[model samples]
Target: MTARDEILGRVRKGVGKGDFAQRKIDAQAWLTARTRGPQPALAGDLLERFRNKAESLSSTVEAVADRGAVPAAVARYLAAQNLGTEVVMTPDVAALNWIAHGVRGTARAAADADRVGVTACFCAVAETGTLMLLSAPDSPATVSLLPETHIALVDASRVVATMEDAFALLRAERGEIPRAINFVSGPSRTGDIEQTIVLGAHGPCRVHLILIGTSS
Candidate 1:
């Protein structure tokens, strides 16, 4: 017998040989099963808990009436921060009339010079105040990673109580995982330098979230 086959035979014999194919099939079935484990208790209003947790992480949150109101809110934020009005956004949100609000919007991946990036999130985790973004053709990952400032638009109805709920939503909606899944809790920070906290060490220094279809 071939060396590989001989080794496998020896292992099977020592372990009391059984149906290898059936074992593989059973393992696959178990993986595909929608089995849930014990989760922590998360109470109270999900949206309110999400807002409080996000604010605690130093992320600015705003409530907008609908998708059409996003541009004006973005413009206001930029103006308030004395930042430029030009932003690179993912194709999913590029259809909004950003120019009418005195902000220029480019629907493409972010370039090094792009200071701000705007994209729509797949969901938000209320437990940790995290925004979950799935990367796809319409939702380029570069728009959120390469910019100095990241602005996310989350639908209020899409907020979930925990991370497990977010994953379940992903499986129910997308069926399979995307190329990349980003969970952004807040602006990037690092405390590795002499134990001193430093923001914007690896990613955006500022993160802003606009909750659509919610009252302020």
Candidate 2:
């Protein structure tokens, strides 16, 4: 047999005595009963806390009254930054009227030439101001990774209190975890050179978060 098959065979022989179905159920129960360790008590609303923490991590934050205002806000941000109007966005946010607000958004993987990219996070964590993104056919990771500027649209309702809470929501909503789960705190930075910090050393130079409170 092949090396991979041989290794698998040996592993199975060692632990294949019990009922796999029962083991799976037991493992699931254990996961459900898992408890989180001590966490820092954070006050204030989740959205505000998330915004404040994100800003501390060097991410710019803005809040919108509703989802319909997103495109205009994006345009305003681009204008303020003097960035190109053309953007690569995830399909999830493609419903926004980008063209009406003097922006062009293409739903696809970001190319090397793409300067701005827009995306929507699966969920956000208030404890660390971290964003969680699950990879899918419509939500390619590249849209958030390869651009000079990355803008994420977050729904206030999806904000979780902590990392553990975020994972719990993930497990509850998506029974099977995706192949890629990305957690981003802010812009890509590196302090590896003589302890001098540099932005965009490995990825996007800037990260902007737009929190949507309501869709109506």
Regions of candidate 1 where Cα sits further than 4 Å from its true position: 8-28
- lDDT of prediction 2: 0.92
TM-scores for all candidates? 0.89, 0.89
Superposed model 2: Cα runs more than 4 Å off: 1-12, 15-26, 214-216
Local distance difference test, per candidate? 0.92, 0.92
lDDT of 2 by residue, 1-216 (tens): 899988888887678644788778878898878888899888888887888899999999888888999999999999999997999999989998888999999999989999999999999999999999999988999999999999999999999999988988998999888999999999999999999999999899999999999433
- Residue 120 C-alpha lDDT in model 2: 98
The per-candidate count of clashes, in order, stands at 0, 0
- Residues 1-216, model 1: lDDT tens digits: 899999999899776566878777776688778577888788888999999999999899999989889999999999988788889999999889898999999899888999999999999999999999999999999999889899999999999998989998998999888999999999999999899988789999999999999867
- Model 1 score (lDDT): 0.92
